[model samples]
Target: MRVQGTPDELVTILRETVVSLVRRDGPDLSARQLGVFLTVYLGPGPHTVRGLAASLNVSKPAITRGLDRLGEFDLVQRKIDPADRRSVLAQRTKRGAALLREISAAMADAATPQENATAPTNSQLARSV
Candidate 1:
């Protein structure tokens, strides 16, 4: 469906969807973890920790921490870059793909109107944002 709203409005809807989702079903993630996860899952891969850090403007240690959490959830895997034994690559997992699909579906549901979507209030989303 066509998303009919200002960008901020659309963002509000999406923020609410995410809050409801986490409250109802969790694999609750911090902002940092979510950012790293999205970058790896959405961006071109054979993703390296250094690349993620530079792209996200975070430190290698921070990326490693987030990756560790994602790894605990089986949402990402760190593999030795076969071409370079000294470096490791971050790869998406089946579970991570499933989570992304779930998020897409949630965004769709949030965008739909007259659907009785259950989520936090706009104020809550605004505060969080």
Candidate 2:
């Protein structure tokens, strides 16, 4: 679908999507955690804590803390890079993929307007007359 919107409309869609996510019964991720999760899942592979910190312009400890939170929910996992044992690679999990699907669904739903809620139906207008 062609998605053309003003800045305000875009913000409204974002707000609705976030509200839907917040209401769902699942792992609640902070902004930082979500950022890290998205980066690990969407970005190129061979991701490390130091690399993520550099990509996000944050400290290594901050990335580590976000990874710890994501790990608790099993959204991400860390493994030692065999090529370089000293470096740890961040990997995506099935649960994380599922969450991304849910997020996409929520955004689609939010983008589709609910006509019933936004306007009065013909039957209601007739009854009032």
Candidate 3:
């Protein structure tokens, strides 16, 4: 993200990111779901179910279940793999990309000390965390 800061500053940034997400009513993604989603979006993908299972140290069915939730949110799409017809490929979606942008924006907002009354400061965010 090119976000430069010390460990404590980064901690403050992360804390603020959480508060910003909650304050802005962002999607509440489970760690597993977020993992799958981020892997698809951030990493090189044409990603297969088997690959995801291995990479995440999770079961194929668990990945499938997480994909179901992500698909419901329009965050991911499952397609029959062209090269390996037997496999399924997990692909990203526009909505998912938009959500990432939303998160990044919130994090950026968080980095700048909150001036508004509704948004919490880093200390308040730390307490919540």
Candidate 2 TM-score versus the reference? 0.84
Go through the candidates in order and give the C-alpha RMSD of each one to the true structure.
Answer: 4.0, 7.5, 3.8
- The clash number for model 1 is 0
* lDDT scores in order: 0.86, 0.88, 0.83
* Tens digit per residue, CA lDDT, model 2, 2-119: 7787655666678788999999999888989989998998899889999999999999999999999999999999999999999999999999999999999999997787777553
Better of 1 and 2 by TM-score: 2
Candidate 1 or 3, higher lDDT?
A: 1
Residue-wise C-alpha lDDT for candidate 1, range 1-129, written one tens digit per residue? 585787666777777678766976658888899899999989988799999999999999999999999999898999999999998899999999998888778777767775665556566777999
Specify the poorest-scoring 10-residue window by lDDT in model 1.
114-123
**TM-scores for candidates 1 onward, in order:** 0.81, 0.84, 0.76
lDDT of 3 by residue, 1-129 (tens): 576876666876776777666676556778799889988898887789889999899999999999999999899999999898999999989999998898788778767755553645466677998
Per-model clash counts, in order, read 0, 0, 0
